[model samples]
Target: MSLEDLVRGAAAEARRLAAAFPAAGRKDDLPWAVIAAFDADVRGHVERDRRIEDERDRVLIASVTLAETPAEAEAEEWDRARRHLVRAVDYLEETVLRFGIVNRLAAKRGHGAAGDPVSALRRG
Candidate 1:
């Protein structure tokens, strides 16, 4: 799927999950481990999706630079590079979805009712 489509989907899902975290009482002074999970979950989603965009753009640039020498480039080398870049992009998108879920879970649980303690998550 396109990067914009992927990001929009992630954002929508994150919002849905965040809305539910509180009703489930998922916040009950969750264990440090759980909190860590929550943090990772949220950050992971954001960072992963971001990384996907970054890697994709990077690959686009590199690929463009290499386009002039298609005959000179080894097939195997090109294939390998393409595979790695695709994998990186996939990983980024997956993580973004995962962390988005975690953030939603956290928000639903009243983890930030008094104030958003995890404001960092809101930042880019």
Candidate 2:
């Protein structure tokens, strides 16, 4: 899927989880699942997608600076490699920050639930 689509999906899931942040009364595994998936998608792109090496590198660095696991560390490093592309993304009409809010909230929820930073990156 396109990066925008992925971010939107992640943002939607984050909003869903935020609606039930503590997950005290939730019955489904949607939040966890969505977070896991989102993280995995980001990780996948950083590791294999070559269409936008620069964008991928920037994202990977930002993500790694934000991760707390060996896997996450690796993924984040890949993102960092494309730091030079930051300027390009800034010029683009579609910014990655669109999903910033939701992504943060989701991270908090994942950390609280799984006690692992990387786990928060994923949907489940």
Candidate 3:
């Protein structure tokens, strides 16, 4: 899948997890599987693209932090997890926007045929 699609999916899953926080009585009640999948997806992109490494790193860190919540987490812990999810979503969305802007600028400058702006920038 495209980097954009992967980031978007991670963002969507993060948002979903945040929304589900209200019903979660403990960390285990939250979606650990989904968080793990999101981490793997973003890590894959980070391995492939140096340009987005920083942003993807932030997302990964936030998700990992959220995932590390105590099994017997309280309201405060849940709130913290929700905030981390928000951070991940924010960074993922920012990465998506950056990708769009970079791609458009690359295309306008006659570099579209070279593939994604990330690869083109690397080539330069």
lDDT of all predictions, in order shown? Answer: 0.38, 0.36, 0.55
lDDT of 3 by residue, 1-124 (tens): 4445555676687677666654543544445544554566544333244545565566556656676666587878868877876876676566544553234433454434324533323335
Question: Candidate 2: misplaced stretches above 4 Å?
Answer: 24-34, 47-124
Residue-wise C-alpha lDDT for candidate 1, range 19-110, written one tens digit per residue: 33233233332122222332343443332345445543543443333333244568676555444434443454454433433234444544
Candidates ranked, most accurate by lDDT first: 3, 1, 2
Q: Which residue pairs does candidate 3 place in steric collision? A: none
Ranking 2 against 3 by lDDT, winner: 3
* TM-score to native of every candidate shown: 0.31, 0.29, 0.49
Each candidate: RMSD = 17.3, 16.7, 7.4
Task: Using TM-score, give the best candidate's number.
Answer: 3
Better candidate number, 1 or 2, judged by lDDT: 1
What lDDT score goes with residue 81 in model 3?
74
Using TM-score as the measure, what is the rank order of every candidate, best first? 3, 1, 2
Error of 3 at 30 (Å): 8.7
Cα RMSD for predicted model 3: 7.4
Which is better, 1 or 3, measured by TM-score? Answer: 3
> Runs in model 3 with CA error above 4 Å?
1-9, 21-51, 100-124
